[model samples]
Target: MTTRKIVVSALVSALAGGTQLAQATDVFRLEGFGAISRGMGGTAVAHDVGPAGMMTNPATLSLMPDGDQAMIGLDLVTTDIKVTNKATGESVSSDTHSNNRGPYVAPEAAFTKRIGAWSLGVGAFAQGGLGTEYGNGSFLSRATGGLATGLDNSSRLLVLNIPFAASFQVNDKLTVGGSVDAMWQGLNLDLLLGADQVVSLIGANRATGSLVGVLAGIPGLSGAHFSLTKDKFLASGVDAWGYGGKLGMLYKATQDTTLGASYTLKSQMNDMEGGATLTAVTAGGQIPLTGKIKIQDFQMPSHLDLGISHRLTPQWTVAADVSRVFWKDVMKDIKVAFVADAGGDLNILLPQDYKDQTILSLGAAYALNDSLTLRGGLRFASQALRSSTLFAVIPATPRKHLSAGFTYAFSKQAKLDFAYSHAFKETMDNTSLPNTSAPIEVTHAQNNATLNFRYSF
Candidate 1:
């Protein structure tokens, strides 16, 4: 293979290995794209952040200097997550339990070349994910009175994107660009559901057919609990591949001001299939069955962003963005089916009832000197999922964020960029599922850092 091909292959492998686990800020999506963008509050639609823009606004690639540029970056994420199941019952009431999964790490790489009016690039990025883990001894498992022992409560969702993008400078003031992304995603789950909750979901969605009848007729099943577990980590779990794309435009409205916009299409993915164990806790005993599991219709949501950036002075620049994500259309329900080896089949539905989300970002960057730059930003977002339906496995409840970072140039061709961000703690009472007298309280908070090494010729 040629040198360029080899580099691309290595970068792809690195990205695949790096997206094993991630805790995001904007529900399942990350708060930022690159170090520079993260420092200034996850703003990328109007500002230029090199090849990383392919994952944000591909048209921004046109703003780079006319040369070859490459970047390798890593994101270090730390999460503070705790789940509390407060019940008034006698056998299942318990205290708070913590998720000991992270700090996590995700790697990314991109190469872009600008020639005349056309800019082209290829890049790999860990778009985002959600994860949480609790031991079997916790209240979630003990709620089953040892009927669900060894069945820990956990879940993980990982997504990665590889985009081949191209941008054209339509005129002196307008640039248009787009990218075709190859998407890959994986899921790991170890969830235990009460019999009452399962029955409730089936009624809520009006699920029908012979399979549903068979499940309802099973003896001693009404008072039982169900556990769906795939014995794997987030890295090597049941996975699927899909395709999606984004369209973007940049308009140089004036000498120092620019307007930008982008829209991402929802992913088209196949069902994720893999081996799993299904355990049923009943009055008679615990029934563990070996089976193959299928996660059906799990797809990411689509979103649109509008933004503007302007240079206040020779050394200061400011940007703002408004975004809307169509979550309700995609996250309403997720179905899982299990076909046992010995006999029997079962199906269940996970209801999200998520609403569309709106986000606002504001950031500023200052060139302190020729060799150094400073950045800061703030982000506010509306709720995506209803708190009453929240669970430990998916606590997507971050509403506000603060971020800061800097870029230090060592020479003309090399620079190091770093950024830090914090998602404040959010706690909510979930009284919807896992049917108990009292509500389940979920608290989540996070901190993140991005470091990148950039080189250009």
Candidate 2:
């Protein structure tokens, strides 16, 4: 297909998958096609030749002193999430629905070259994003008890970052570079809840309790008929914008060994304002509650990345990386300011906090010949969040990743790349709910695949 067609088709698929905005949590994965490629053993040259290298290490762009290069790539992901209610011994399941719409297509483009004494370049790419959905039907029957209660949640985060970098050759065997980044980001979220079963339970309790009261001292209570109507509560689309910066460095100890590190500061977003609609039966009539809520500015956590790569032979190279995400910074309560139509204001819900996380990854690559290369790697990430902080509105599983990829060089200027990753199955059990005798448990699994076409001039 033409490049335009591919971009359009990929966008349509991405939007359909974007519908799961409510199920996304604060935690996200950093692995992408570029990093996956680098993880396999591609050395960062003083010249730009691969799309993966630009994102994995922007300083590598300055290494490309020969020609200016640009690239576009796509990624596809699949995930499986299961939650078991430990109280009742029942399970709930969800998947990367609709042809694995769970994946994202990340497009990258960069321009770089070397001057008499400096190498400079600029590029744009996605920094972080997430999507997930859970159907009520996934809940076990014993837990649901034939009640039509379910949840639908969706969310998306998009970031556009441009980095200007320059590299200087300090010595015969060493090079150093630094970058200043300007970033813009967007966020969207939606949540829905169906509580027919909870309403029925409330109604039944009212009737039985009223009868007992009438037999004692309240004669009129026994004659009252208890009734309840199901209600649907929904929080619609909310959006926000933010800014941040990144700094990085690269060191070449020898011709075959390289070390790199980078730090990306957190972006502080503008407060979000959106309307919410709550439908319910109140005092013998259907009442619709409509109001606007102000979500305070929330800051995304900062990231620390360290990596090392070494060439073992003329055709073989290996690399490893460690990343730390300060999720604890996100673990504060989210406060929503409510504004009444009458012009009064109130605090809706208390703020919510999240737990911290860490990720470790290692990869290797081998060149079969001048034209064929193979890569593989492993990544392990910490759990999504503490059970005490998890909510039905957002469900996620901690993940362990295994991946393999290959590149076929059509020529020195072009190559075709393919990668596949499978997330090992893992489960989580929740037994802590206020005033509940039974605890809820959730389990999850995830996977992804990607194809990239790269060219350098």
Candidate 3:
């Protein structure tokens, strides 16, 4: 084999091994931002100040009055992503991954009442959800030696948050509130890899082709063919649910200034079971290999947010928030059983010691006039999932952001909000692989934008 062929084969082997490590553990860090302008700007409006606020900061519900208020909104999002290899000249490029996903309704309803010096509120809302897909045959099938291989992977997640909160008015200048949340989450993954034709080539090369050519004809092995064929398939699916809580305090330090702080506790899910089917075909008929995976425990990281909002004037306000995700607590490696019908069982594992991340955000909103409001913000977010843990199925980008948005009140009870954000470019270089001294580098660039509308009564 030539040096180029050797390098390409080595790279492919490294990628396969790296992906295997990533599959043992599942890491999800997608946060659902609200469809409303204010909600999207600052930790989603403390979870109660607006119709959608209950999605994140439930205690903010105390800011509402006794009347029933309902809000329904839609979000339109577009994303652009590119992946390339700098080492080899082979490149795969496309804009097909860029598409609009939602207008999927985000709705919220709340009831609030004041008793003595305290306020009580109850609310239900769709906190946030994620859905993304990118697939094409050409991108997956490119291979070396004029050979082609196909692979595809996709995933989806749905999450719901229900919160109950109470606020106590301490004198006339301060208020404190806390909320307990009941969270429901579900996730699904689908992956397809390896092809029968590709396996046939491997088998042929190892068996007949390696010994049947001119060199073989000159030896005593003439006209003799020795080959081994390999065919394998893998499929898996899982479902789980869990609960968590949030504690928050709001201090009206002065008539025009307010300070807020909150901490959300980590939640763990236990009752999850899934099945994986693997089939390996050789010169003989396909043999079925199946096994069950029991998820012992999985936890989402805890987060803390500190925010300050100041009303400079009756028509102008500014807000800023800094938050940290405690990824350190997520330190358990995932363990699973890889069983073959006759081969017994082997252990597949993935490490979960991810690094902690911080996010800093700042925004300002100005009432252009009575019915119109203009808003803008800047945000910086640290990467949560390490490249060693990332696979083709979940392509998330690390980012910095610039955003602008507007809200127009159509009437006393209805309003419309719109926002656009651009995430600055960043790259990830992963070198961790098993049994290999070299690393395969995969680089990605991302851009996303969103628009939404909100109404209240």
Q: State the RMSD for candidate 1.
A: 3.5
Candidate 1 is scored at a TM of 0.91
Tens digit of per-residue lDDT, candidate 3, span 99-205: 22222233334444567766665554444433334343533333222223232224444445556666676766556766776765544443332233223323434
Query: How accurate locally, in lDDT, is each candidate?
Result: 0.78, 0.52, 0.48
Query: Which 10-residue window in model 2 sums to the lowest lDDT?
Result: 221-230
Cα miss at 59, model 1 (Å)? Answer: 0.2
**Per-prediction CA RMSD (Å):** 3.5, 8.4, 14.4
Best candidate, lDDT: 1
lDDT of 2: 0.52
- Runs in model 3 deviating more than 4 A are 1-32, 36-40, 44-49, 91-149, 191-236, 279-288, 331-346, 434-457
lDDT of 2 by residue, 352-428 (tens): 35666677777888889989888888777787476664554345564577778888889886677777777677655
Tell me the number of clashing residue pairs for each predicted model.
0, 27, 7
State how far residue 417 of model 3 sits from its true place (Å). Answer: 2.7
Ten-residue stretch with the least lDDT total in model 1: 89-98
Candidate 1 lDDT tens digits, 325-383: 99988888777777778766766666778999999999999999989999999999999
Best-to-worst lDDT order: 1, 2, 3
